[model samples]
Each structure stands twice: as structure tokens, then as C-alpha cells.
Target: MHPYDTIVSRDVDAFPLGEFLDYPRLMSVDWREEEPRMLSAFFTATGLPADGTTLEMDDRTSYYQLVRGSDRVDVPWGDEVSAQHSMLVALQRVFGASHSIRYLNHGCADTASFVVETNEDWRRLESANPHVRWFFTPIERLPDVFKSDIDELVRVGETYGGA
Candidate 1:
């Protein structure tokens, strides 16, 4: 399993889907035949400027890359705790406390993809809230360092369908 670079909520309307198109580091590669003008127009409609830097095409696939200055954002990719914290902050910024934020991390080969169920208690956001629900592959498949963490999460979830 690979660590997820993107987190998506299962609910389509949980947040504004179009906001994802504006993410600075988002890069997409599509294997399709389409006109350049059409691509440009699509990007423009999604709030991306029609500058030359927004799109790229190769013999194999066509892709869009959203580039921005690195100074603008700080994303945590190396540490799990940091990454979780970062995601919590992002979800709060995007959806606030009105919605139950369920997100999936599309992990890669070396990392395990997991789903986080963010309700009031998850992430210790509110004292009155309940515990967070974390879902992942079996504990045997996780790294040694992560095993205990997963076990604890499982133990917590056993009472509330968290696993």
C-alpha cells in the first residue's frame, strides 16, 4: 500500500467538488484525445487561468498541472500524525463542523491507504464528541511502528464500529 496523496469524501456533495480543481499542487493526466482549446476552456471555467503553465500534453496522455508558489502552503506528507493533523485542519477550513467528514487517502505501493471518519470526537476536535473511526488493511500488513497504533484504533473502534 502507498501513502495517500489525496483524500476524498465518499459523499459527493460533502464539499464543493470544484474546489479541488483549484488546489495548487493538483496534477492530472488523462489518456484521451481532445482539442487543446477545449482543454483550455475547461481549465478556465474551473478557475484556473488560461496561462501556458496550466496544461501539458505528451504522446501518451494529456494532463493538467496546477502550479503555485511553494511559499503559500505547507503540507505534511512524511509523518502520519502531521499528515492527519494537516487533513483535520483542511477539513475544518473547507467544511467546518456542519458535516461529517469522511475521507480516503489513496496510498501508494509502500504506504497503506486508509479512511478516516471525522465526526465530533474524531481528532479530538471537541470534548463532547466521540472517538474517531479509522479504517485500514489488517494489522499484519502494517509496518511495525504503525501496528500498535492500528491496534489501539481497533480497540477503540470495537465499541463503536470504528475499525
Candidate 2:
């Protein structure tokens, strides 16, 4: 049996996720700010300092973002859409493939809802532009050391990074 089955036994089907993350209340975002300020907010909220971490953001394209630390954390949140997308990917990794997921896009929904919507967006983007970049595979391919470590999961602005 799959390891995730024990954790996701209660779930019946896949749906988009809704705010499944348990970030600190201190997290906030300023969409109007420039990239640097946005970056600063991300690190501050996540309690990570600059020159202490290496980071990456994978969305339409894979790009490197600034962070402090030797290990890597992937941050994809900056806007609501990206946050949704990030949440979906996170759920898939955590809950296992058999679990149902969804994303309501607007109002409150269960964690599964969030995952579906985010994934739907990602799929739409990829379909429109096959060249569109995505970090899902790369991140999914990461070794277990990075995937399971909460300490390695760093947050930035509205994004998150993992070892």
C-alpha cells in the first residue's frame, strides 16, 4: 500500500485546495512593491535571512530568486494565482496521487479544492504554451531529504521554498 493512503484515507476524490498551508500569522504580501521589497517581505515573514539560503521559483518559467542559506527552498507565491498553484503542487506531494483534490478559485473550500484549481491553472498554462516553464517535475524529483523537512520549507512574501 502507498504510504500516503494512511494519511489521505478520509479523502474521497480530487478537488482544488483552499488555503491548506499553516503559515505563521505574521506572513503578508505587498503586491504593489518592487521585486526587491517583495523579496524582503518573503524572507522576513519566513524568518529567513539573506545570504543564508538559496532559492528558486518555478512557474511559467524556472528562475532563481534570492535567499539566504545553503539549502534550497522553492517560492512560487507572489499573487493569488501563483499561491493557488503552489498550494496544489504542495498537496499532491504531501497527500499522494490517489487523493482527490479541487480548487474553488474564490470562496472557501477544502484543502483538496485548492490543489485541483492550482493544478488546473498550471495545466491550462502549459497547454497554451507548451514551452511554458514548470518546476513541478524538478521539485518532485528532489531527494527525500528536502521534501520532508519543515525546517527546509522557507516562506517568502506569498511564496515558499523547500530543501
Candidate 3:
């Protein structure tokens, strides 16, 4: 079945992995998606820090706070490193492995890719608000290596944040 055929609307509280991959609405997403906001949620899901401000990554569980005044990374389009790498691992686990993943920047604004990936709107949500920076691609082109690297990053990020 086509990747688009798999995604569907999902509850915001639940990790909509199964629904997203099963049925994608590509035309509607924001640029700076809700990534920063979801940091806590991601942490909570993996038995890490649930607080949004500080992060505990790696096995040692070092702590890192959300930097202030640091420019958020811009989301990437097809083939961009941001789209392929970054939070690939965590999302893969939340959603599943059969689906492909990628990120995209909003043409309307500049924002961190991290913020975008975690949002529900993904890409098109930004059009209305112009704040959406992150958007995930359909599950048609995910790479195996990308998924593995993401897993590693999560492990390390968790350690650094002290989750």
C-alpha cells in the first residue's frame, strides 16, 4: 500500500505514529512545528525527563537546559540532513520502523527543525500561523542508517539531559 494510504488523524496525547504513516495530509503543515514543546513528552515516553526546560541524555544522565537566545535550527526539505537525521530515532520508536521519516522548513519563516518535527500539523500547519518550522515527510523514503543514528542520538541526548 502507498504510504499516504496509511496515515490518519490521531490524538495529540498519543504518539500518532501508526496514524501518521497510514495516512498523510501533505498539503497542510507548519514550518516550526511543535518540537520544543514536545521535548518533555518525548522524554516522558522513553523514561527520560518530562520537563521541557532541562534534558537528561546519555547513560550517565548529564543535564542540559534549553539554551536561551540560540537560533532554532531551520527545518530541511527532501534530502536535507535535518530531514534525515536529528530526531529520527525517537520518532521511529514512537511511531514504528515501517514508516519513512523526514523534516521540512517553512517557507514563511525560519525556526528550529527540532520544533517542527514534534508538531501535529507537521508542515501545512505553519501556513496559517507562519510559525511552523518542522514537517515530516511521508513514509516513502526513510533510510535504515538514519533510523539507527537517531536511536544513538536519543541514547546520548537522554544521557546528557540526565533523564
Best lDDT among the predictions, by candidate number: 3
Q: What is the TM-score of each candidate against the true structure?
A: 0.25, 0.23, 0.23
By lDDT, the candidates rank as: 3, 2, 1
For model 2, what is the alpha-carbon lDDT of residue 108?
28
lDDT of 1 by residue, 65-143 (tens): 2223321123232434233333333323333343233321122223322222234324453232222122222222233
Which parts of model 3 are misplaced by more than 4 Å?
1-37, 41-56, 60-85, 97-109, 112-136, 139-163
Which candidate achieves the best TM-score against the true structure? Answer: 1
RMSD to truth, every model = 14.1, 15.9, 15.8
Kindly provide the TM-score of model 1 when superposed on the true structure, using C-alpha atoms.
Answer: 0.25
Candidate 3, residues 70-126, lDDT tens digits: the string is 322222224443333333334444443232234322121222222213334443443
Query: Is candidate 1 or 2 superior in lDDT?
Result: 2
Residue 44 local lDDT, model 3: 40
User: For residue 19, what is the lDDT in candidate 3?
Assistant: 40
- Candidate 2 is scored at a TM of 0.23
